[model samples]
Structure formats: C-alpha cells, structure tokens
Target chain A: MVVRGCENRSVNALVVEKQKSRENLFLIGVPCEGILDWHKIVSEVGEAVTAVKEDGQNLMVETRDGYQLLERADFLHDSCKRCIHPNPMSADILIGEPLPEGDPNLARTTVENFETQTIEDRYAWFQKEAERCIRCYACRQACPMCYCEECFVDHIEPRWTESGATPAGMQGWHIVRAFHQTGRCTSCGACERACPMDIKMTYLTEKLNHDMRDKYNFEAGLDAQSQPPFAAVTLDDKNRFTVRGE
Target chain B: MNHILEKHTLQDLLQSWRQDYDVYLPQKMENFSHFMPLTETSVLVDGDPHNTRIPPKALFLPMNEALVKFTRFGGYEDAKHEIQSRIVFGIRPCDAQAVQLLDTSFIQEDNIDPLWSERREKTITIGLGCHEPCQTGFCTTVGYGPFDRADLDAMLTDLGETYLVETFSEAGEGCFLGLPVASEEIYNQALDIQRSAHDQMPVAFETENLKGKLEQNFKSDYWDTVSQSCLGCGVCTFLCPTCFCFDIVDETQRRERVRNWDSCMFRTYSLEASGHNPRPSRVERTRQRLSHKYVYWLDQVNQIGCTGCGRCVRYCPVGLDIRAMLRQAQTLPFEVSHAA
Candidate 1:
C-alpha cells in the first residue's frame, strides 16, 4: 500500500491494535510536501477553469476568465499547513527526498488559538459548526482509523448517540468522534476537506492529540509496538507516564 | 410583467417582503453561501460561488424532522409542523427544477407527505439566472440551462446595475408589482445575456442512449472503476439538489420518530435486518446512486434525476467528477436492442 506520513501512522496504530499484521504489509512511503486545497484554488480562480497544471511550487491554471499562477504554499490545506511530519516514520520502501520536518509550534499555535478563546465563545463556535452538520459521516469515511464494521452510531438496540441531524446528535457525534481519536489521529485533515459544509474538524482531534502529547509524552504511530494511551496497561503504577517504555 | 430592479435597492426589495412573507436568500456562511432568512442587515453576495453549498431542497425537506411525537401511556400524535409562507430568493434554476422533480415523488397518489407538501405550497421560489454561469455547472448538458425556469415563480436576469425581473405567476408579480417596467430594448438585452450564458456551457456528456447503456451494463466493471476512489460517504447525496432518501429512526429517549437524510452511498442504507445487504459494497452502492439518477428516474418520470448543479463534482473528496464517469460510461459496450 502507498501511504503518506499520516496514513503510515494510522497503519502503525492499526498494527498495534491487531487490525493488520505488519509482516504481511508492504508500505511504499511517498514524502508529502502538502495537499493543495481545491477549495482555495477555486476561490482564487473563480470561473472558466479549463485546465490546472500542478508543479513543485506553482499551479498554472488556465481559465476563460484569466490565467493564474497560484503559489502552492498559499493553497496548502489547513492540516497540511501545520503538519509536523511529512516523511513516513515506518515504510519498507521510500521514494523521493523527504521534505524538511514541519514546525511543532505551528500545530501548537492552531490548538492554542482555539484554546485561548473563552469557554462561552468556544462553545458558541462549536455550536455554529456542529449545527451545520448534515450527519453525512464523510469525516468518518475519510479517516483511516474509522474502519469499524458497524459504527457506534449505527448500533440500534443500545444506541450510543442520536442517529438524526439534530443539534444534540451532531454535537455528540463530533465530540465523541474526536475523543475516540485521542491518541490515534495523525492530523491528516481529510475529514475537514471531505466535509461539504466546510466544518473545521481537525481542531477537535488536534486538541485531543495535543493533550495526549502533553500529559503522557506519547505521539501515535511512532512505532508499531507501542499501544495508544487508552489501550496501554499500566499495572496500577503510581506514576501514569512511567510505565510507557518499561 | 417585466420590470427593472436597481441593484442598490436589492436588499430593500428583499427585506420589504418580510412584512407579508419570510424572505430567505443565499447569505454568506463561512466561505460558501447558505439559504438564510433575510434580516435587516442581510447583504447579498452576487454570483460568487454560483450557488449555495446545500440546495434550497433542504428548506422543504429538512435534514432532520420529527414525524411523530410519542406521549405518556403509549400514545402518539403527529408532530406539529408550522410552515411559514417564504420567498426563496436567488435560487438557481436547476434547483427549482429539482423541487419540481421531487414533487412527483413526495406528493404522490397514495403517499402525500403533508410536511413536504405544506412547505412547497408556502414557499415562493424566486430564481436568479446565471449571466456568467459557473464553469463547474453543466445544467445545459442535462436538458436544463442556467436560465431554466421550469419551477420558479419569477426569474431575475442581472443587468450590471439593474436586474430585469420576469414574473411568471401572481405571487411573483406581487413581489415587484410597484417597480418600473423594463423597456423592450432592456428586456431584449437580458434575453441576449441569458442566450449567451446558455450557449457558453459545453455539453458534458452524450446523453443519447446513455440511460440504456447504464441499464444494460449493470454487471460490468464500470461500477468498480468508478467507485474505487469513493469513500462511501454521503456528502454528494446530502448536498445534492434532487437526491432525497431518508431513514426514519425512533429516538426512544427523545420520544420522537425522526426522519433524517440517508444516502445510498452508505452501507447501512441497504443493510437488511437479517444481516444481508442487497447492495453490498461501494461498487453496488455507486451503481445504485448513478443508475437511479440516470436509468430509474427516466423509467419512472421520463426525466433525468440530476439537475447538474455540480455540488457533487466540486465537493467530492477524491475529485471524482460524475461527468467524467458518465463520459467513460458512454464507452461501455452494450448491444442495442429494439423494443418489440
């Protein structure tokens, strides 16, 4: 399977969870600079888009309206903008020269921006975004970690969440979904990109990821052997973080 | 009657309807536009994104609606649905046509959805014709055009500083009855704009015998080829103007039976209670989605289900264009058989 940095991390997390055996998997790693947002490109070049040529740093777009040479750096997806890792951590074969590592501060800045908002303001923003959800579950489908046979939302007899597009249902789905990816998310930003409503979802998962890093000093999918924080067994140790490597 | 509405007074004209009707227009929500109520401060963003991300179909058939509210002691009553008379402003013609297509399904002989019917009855649609039709949109390819006014009460043609308003019904006439009538030359100019806009659109695919090919090639690998990149998500269907499949779930905790939009793209949509799914994978699901729009809609209504609004094409995560898929489908081999 061809995997990017985020996908490789997801595969490693899956391997640790006994979803797939690492021996049977042969991963081809492609170094990713960033994923260009088509949304941004459209906004930039509005009409008569005949052809778009992708390059290392510029997009030569041909349109009836006008020709535009868009800077690739400006159109990078919000998730890709703050990507901490562009090189696959574990892969049998590697391709191309790996790009320089992304700044950790950039990722921290995004979460901090959300965190710095007052509780009321944060909740208000969450309400505005969550209410717009049509309950399409594109976010779930796009996430590599969301490979459940039947999602918890679909469980009929013992329904975990409301299956409608109500405020309660939408909010529950978003919050629970982000929590589920606490130590497992690799910040691919596929969910945000997939959303038809353009709801900001990476913020929710990224916050959980930030907490996982801060509290336990654990980053998901650095290795196949390490369990996520939720799945890790500590033997009732006094220090929560001490049992990770031991 | 044809009248000219000056662009500067557009907000005043829209908000003035609020006294007699609830005015809903495409308003900016985040990056894209959404159909929202016209407030005092409502500022119109003209023809930027072409159309709203979610179609005005949502205004009629809400994503979630409570059908039956259960009472204590095992009793139940129909949920109260209060529908206000609304003027949906700036609706693209393709979407208005979609509502007309959906009317055949919802307002049928046996099953007349009162809620859907009520909303349709109350809502007065005012269309804004695309002078500069969106490039992504292929309304012309689907036997509809940028100025297709099959279901609108009134249609507006943008004329730079002024708009040529063409009213088709009494309701439409009432909205702009007091405005000054557009002259013959100005009206002719609007017609020229509409004609040019319609002519600008290139035919996306060959629709001739396209339905027949899809019907015959049900077992072919075209489904696999097209659906390979699909994530089995509902974005396309949910955002679609015409796709109207719903799931009714009884929320026991809430004591209500809620109807929410369901997509054929979902695995659970066709999942039978006996742990068997008729349409199993994304391959079959994709086939169902496309075939329903192309073959089944033709079989049932003698019209294509899609409006060519291009929401699905623009917003697909994998950038899978249905136009490209159908173009590929046009190449699929199927022996032509004449009806005896």
Candidate 2:
C-alpha cells in the first residue's frame, strides 16, 4: 500500500496502489513547491493509476497542496485548505488531518475605523490606492470559493456588470466579489494575497464578515453540515432588511 | 453584562476554548492587522473597531481554495474537508450580518455550496459590539447599528473598565459557563452604557421604502448623472462590507486543473470563451451594480443588500455617494414594478 523513491512516486504511486488494492483511492498532497507542475505529475503516474482502477473510477488525484478538500462539492471549484474530496465517496483509506480551526491571520479592525483625519482625507487615500488597480482579476482568480459557472461580469444577455479597469468598472467588479462571498466566503485571504496591485481587497470581505457575525451570529465555512444563513431562514432570524422600529 | 477577567485571565479563557475549539482573535502583523490563533502571548482585547482589511470569510470560503482536483480522464475524487469547531472573537456587527446574508446565497435549496455549508455548521460566533462607532459606519441607516444584536451567540460591550458579556444563544452561554461570571449590577450598568452609546450614534440613513425607490429609479437619468464623476475604480465594492459577487475559472498548472477567483470588473469578466461581451459599456455595467444591490438582491432575498458600513463611500475614488444615489432614487418620480 506504500511506495517510496519511485522518481514518479507522487503520481505513479496512486495507480500502482489502486491496482494492487482493487479499491477506490484518492490521493491528497501538495504539489512539490516551485518545481512541481501538473503535467509532469499526471504524465508520470496518471495513466498507470487509471489503468488499474475498475470502471476507471477508483483512482483520482487532488492537486493544490491539499487545499482542494475545503470545497466539499464537485471538482469544478478549488479548495482553500485541502482537497474537496479528500474523504473518499466510498473507500477504506483516508488521507490527511481535517482542516484546523480558527482564523489563520485575520485583521481585527474595521477598515472604516482606521484614523484618516477626515472623510475627504480617507476618500483621497483610498482613491490613490484604488487607482493602482489594473483590473487584472488576480484576486478573483486566486480565490478558491468562486465557483459560478457563469459570472455576472461575463453574462452578456443581461450584462450584470462591466469589464474594464475604470473606476466604475472596478467598483462593479469589487462590489460583486464581496457580495458573492457574503455568507459563503471562508475568509482564506487568497484574493488579497493574490492581488498584484495589493488593493487590500480583504477589507471588503472583512467588513462583511464582521457584519455577518455581529448581526446573525453566523460565520461562513465554520461547519460543513450546517446550512448557510442566507439559504436557510428562521422566523426569529433578525431581518436587517425589515423596517426599523423607532 | 459585567464580567471580570483578571488582567491576563482572558488568555486562560482562550486557551480553554482552544482545547475544544479553534480560538481566533485579532493580532497585529508588522504594519497590517490580522486575526490569529489565541496563544499565551496573544492580546485578548483592544479598542480599535477599524475594519480589518481581511474578512473572516477566509476561515470559511478561502481564496484559491481547492474544491476538487482530478486527473485528465474520468477518474473521480472527493475532497475530505472536515469542519472544525471554532470561535471567532471580536467580530464586528456589520461583518456578522454579512455572514448571515451570505448564508442566503450559499445555503439556498437549489444550489448550496458545500464548502461554505461545512464551515457554517461547526463555528460559534462571539461578537464585540462597537464601543466607538466608525465614521464610515452607517449601519443604523440600513436597519443595522453600531451595536445591533441580530447575530451573535454572545456579545461583549466595552464598559470603560470591564466588559459586559451577554449570551444570546445557548452556545454563547456555554462559552461563558465555566469562565468567570459577571455581577447583575455590573451587567445592568453595562446595558445602560450600551443603550446610551446606541442612542448617541449619529450616522444614519433613511431606508423608508428604499427598495421601492431603487426599483422606480432603475433606469432614471440619475444613474448617468450620479455616476458621471465615477472613475470606475472598484474601491467602493472592494471596501464595502456587504457587496459579494465573484467569478470562477479553471486553469491548468503542469497539467493539474485549478480554479480561481475572477471579478466582474475585468473586460474579460463577461467575455465568454466565445468572445461576446455582455456588459460592453461602463454605464450599463454601473447600472447593473446599483440595481443588483438596491433592486435585485432585495427582490430575491427580501433584504436590502447593503449594511451602510460606508467602506464603499469612504474608499470610492470619485466620491460616488451611494447614500446620495439612494436618496435621489427615493425622491425620483418613477413607477415601481413588482413584476419579474
């Protein structure tokens, strides 16, 4: 059930192991940093693993250094922490520990509360920072939680948002980003981390995260089994959208 | 509301919680800020309501996360992501509400995102009420306030010298059950102070028939007029606490498949692989943005999609006042339609 130093061990081992075990097997591991590429990993061992599995359903490889498991749905999306299907749908052997608890490096302050002297001053500071955005979508591309088949930005029939680096376009982009991740975002920090312009995109998500927690006592991605707050409704759930009482 | 922690006793409480659940608190990084795991050295409480540049959403829905990785062929695999029981400390009310709102999108009947559902299941939230409301905060205007208590297992209000912790859920009560208990007199005093603080909050927005107003003004000339000065920078959306929309794309690295976050603002955001662009004009795109929040989200969720956190207002480069836009929408002489 174990192989070492196969040269193609990372890729080949899965196929080899599946053939011998005659059972559905899932491989979870990080690509070797920097040097590791998907093609090499697949070419070296992918074919061999597939040949051995019955119905060719037994062998599968989850790439991304084990982070794909965080997305428990289909393989169409990525995972922030581990493979989406780290646990076998129906298998005997399991791999890796469950995702750890607690926020890794969440900033505690609200971006609005940051002292900037005056509203005009704060706006100016943000303007300068936002002006640096190139509309590259690096933040979007880097996020693991974005799993829409057709994003609003790309929807042509109804055209939900625009596509450009202009301020309005950028506003459309960012607003949609924050709004989409509302209850679903796990706050993995990948978007801000991936932004080439370093636009501090996390500030938006953080603000929303704060709001969700404060208003609903709900935190996204905290549990796999519980329904999202927005998707499920209770009569007692505070309706922020409801008319306020004096 | 009145709970006493021996100067460092908060650390002990955090450690105890850590044993059973992952405990998170705000920590300062060189020049930036973040919430890290609570350790002996972690500072438990501080008085800065400044919205952290990073939302706790990553704890649930991470960027560049792996939903599933597969070989080129029909070989299938499943991700074994497990939900971790945890506690988020010092969560602001706006962010708290944002998570609640997010649930509406992710946990919906037809299309529930499994990853978000998992994280939402096991986590308990402990919110820290705003002791000093931020200048950009207009939660009161959007039917929220500096210290709104819609979503929190427990809430902590700063009372000058001590923290008045109120348990709103059984889980919140359990969080404080074994820890030190607060005196009733102190709790009453903290409540009194919180009431005063709530009353003193000046930032407000008028939401009277706001959704109806937005619907009527969907095609108003006001959009072009208001957006005329807009530079189209995404600061407003990127900074707003409640704006959430994203795109997903698949990429291949060394033959391994990958999916990543994509924004609607990009020229390619709407350009399908077939080369047709839906939102070709900036004006059309702008209209979509405003209407989605004011009109669409409200219509779908029966909730206005904004919390009035003012990150959008404060961060916008061109001073695109969302409040002003909404206000104008309110007064516009347009017919409201409920038809889909």
What range of 10 consecutive residues in model 1 chain B has the weakest lDDT sum?
B331-340
The C-alpha TM-scores of every prediction are: 0.96, 0.56
DockQ of 2: 0.02
Candidate 2: tens digits of C-alpha lDDT, residues A1-246: 321111112123223223223333343332211112222333333312211111221224443233121211221111122222222222233344432332323233444454434978866655655555645555665555664555676565555654434465467787778887776565555565444344656666766766777777865543334455676777776676758922
Model 2 off-target regions past 4 Å? A1-246, B1-7, B30-32, B43-45, B72-74, B254-262, B335-340
**Maximum-lDDT candidate:** 1
Q: Which residue ranges in model 1 land beyond 4 Å of their true spot?
A: A239-246, B338-340
Candidate 1 on A202-231: residue-level lDDT in tens? 889889889989987888888898888787
Q: Write the per-residue lDDT of candidate 2 for residues B2-92, one digit (tens) a residue.
A: 3554434566777889889988877764333456778767754455555554556556655344455556675635445677788988777
TM value for model 2: 0.56
Error of 2 at B88 (Å): 0.8
Indicate which candidate wins on TM-score.
1
Q: How many residue pairs clash in each candidate at the backbone level?
A: 0, 127
